[model samples]
Target chain A: MARTAGSHAETTGPKVRAVALRLFARYGYAAVSMRQIAAEVGVQAGALYNYTPDKQGLLMSLMQGHMHDILEARQATSSEGDAVQQLEAFVKFHIGFHLARPEALFVSYMELRNLEPQNFARIEALRRDYENELEGILARGAAEGVFTLDDPKISTLAIISMLNGVVNWFRPDGRLGLGDVEQIYWGMVRRAVGAAE
Target chain B: MARTAGSHAETTGPKVRAVALRLFARYGYAAVSMRQIAAEVGVQAGALYNYTPDKQGLLMSLMQGHMHDILEARQATSSEGDAVQQLEAFVKFHIGFHLARPEALFVSYMELRNLEPQNFARIEALRRDYENELEGILARGAAEGVFTLDDPKISTLAIISMLNGVVNWFRPDGRLGLGDVEQIYWGMVRRAVGAAE
Candidate 1:
């Protein structure tokens, strides 16, 4: 009986998170209920509590998971290049990473207001860590006299925001391929910072 | 009796929209019901239908009203000048206009998924019209040899996304005032298009 329950949890846990993410992305987090998630996951409402304490816990977990995934993915990429190379790598990596997880990206941005204060702070800290990585690149380029920037922090936010906009309209079968987008956007980012061609 | 009914709608119409917008922004659209909107507006749930056919109608109206408001505001601004000057005007106008209506902006982006197919198409058309305005500017600048852009359409979307990002974090009492933000953002916009200093 104990072994059966353990294995059940192991399989059901991922299914619960996946179904919850889809529902939350389709309907905002506040609108999605634990019972609704359980129904979607083919589990009893009581079984959900065994996995997640409540709706808020599930939301926080999803959001934290997304942030951690992105941060870890970013960390895995090589950061050995100069500021311009680093910035380009960052742009492509961000666009590709976000594009691959549209639902997670949507939930991460939209459901932020629903996070508890402590959870919000933790997620925000993780976000800041990501933003700071780009800011550091801009600062290095400016200091090295390779890029001219009015404000590294603002530029960091602006670039990320601009890159994020791609997910809103990009389609796998769209006219422009992802590689084309990366190049065009990298061009704009390079120019935005007054980096020479 | 007719005059009283007309007067009631005239007053209640705006109130309904205001309450609905607030609730939709605070709680996702799917979570908020017609009764909640009516209660907040001090009206009976059935009375809410007098103003809107259904919850979807209210959502459609609010989203449409926002788009029309911005489009009309954009029209009101003078478009006379070189491309660089015109782009500056657009950047400042967009930031100031969106910053003033944070709730509307939030709902406009967040509730887009909740819009019905036809309603989504209409909102998207309005959005494209806005994007076209910026694309025209970039095209003109590129043609006149004042700006260098790899793709005008892509740049249009990118610039708008960057500007729209300000709504996510701008506060009146924050360290920087609106004017300071406009100047900083405008500087980035000017450079992003490869505009000459």
Candidate 2:
């Protein structure tokens, strides 16, 4: 049965998304069932239709929504500055933002293979938008002779890849704090592009 | 029915592993059933047990085998040299070896979470050993004043992460050939650690 429009949905909707993200991250999208998601969300299997039309819809919504959140947060955190300053901000922002939402980051990358063709394309475009943000910085830096780069496109991917690795091993209670991680990664990102001395 | 020792088992064994790797890479380990793997290998589900005891065994074998291959290949491809030369060899060797086995790399990283606890620990230890190889080089370079590194361990993770990103997007027929990619990545890897001019 479809849910009636009221406070119930407003509260239950976010709950459904939260449950789906966790389930997808823990078990790959292909292995998870809508019944499992509904059970986790404390709703009947039939009631899940009120939240998401199908499993594919849930996967796509979670992924696309994650991209939107990333872009929105990135836009808010990023500063208006020169290429070098902007690149540094990006390194710190990428690590902190991703580290805080490991499940989101993990599911987004891991489930891309499961998205339908059109959904995959949409998510890919959003991802490209994010990558372009950094590429723009590298391009400006290269043109201004402030950085040496053979290909800004490749550098953008390399830098992101390097930064993404932080989530895999970083621990707050471990030897290094988030600040130490940010500083170290910022140094590597800056040097990787051959920023001016 | 289980097959007795024969040439059939010898030939079917490798076929089973290859199919399992492909299926696991396509649909994650948890999602891909043993029946699916056996079907892909042109054998009955029961025949799969003759080769591997169960799904968990198959996953562990594939993962552990991949790590062993990485270590064995690293030892063979790595050349005896000073810090700078060895780092170059590592970057090139890593990219070449990984790119050639995209399916194996994909399944190894993605299905790691699904491995049983004991299996996960064994695979992680092997992974750390491989990481120690690069960390040792960075340590040497830092000591010799050939490189500047705030943390050798973090540098190892960063460099591997950066290089690992290559496998996700690289194509043999893409605009850049393998040699061009090796040179480009090596340059970034070198500068990432503050390698001297």
lDDT of each: 0.89, 0.88
Model 1 lDDT, full chain set: 0.89
Two-chain DockQ for each candidate model? 0.65, 0.72
Query: TM-score per candidate, in order?
Result: 0.90, 0.93
- Write candidate 1's Cα lDDT for A1-197 as tens digits: 23344457778999999999999988788777888998887777888888888889999999999999999999999988788899889999998898888889889988888888999999999999999999999999999999988788888898888988888888989999988998888888888998887
State in Å the error of residue B40, model 2: 2.4
Error of 1 at B190 (Å): 1.7
Best by lDDT: 1
Q: Any runs in candidate 1 off by more than 4 Å, and if so which?
A: A1-8, A33-36, B1-10, B35-47
B169 in model 2: Cα distance from truth in Å? Answer: 0.4
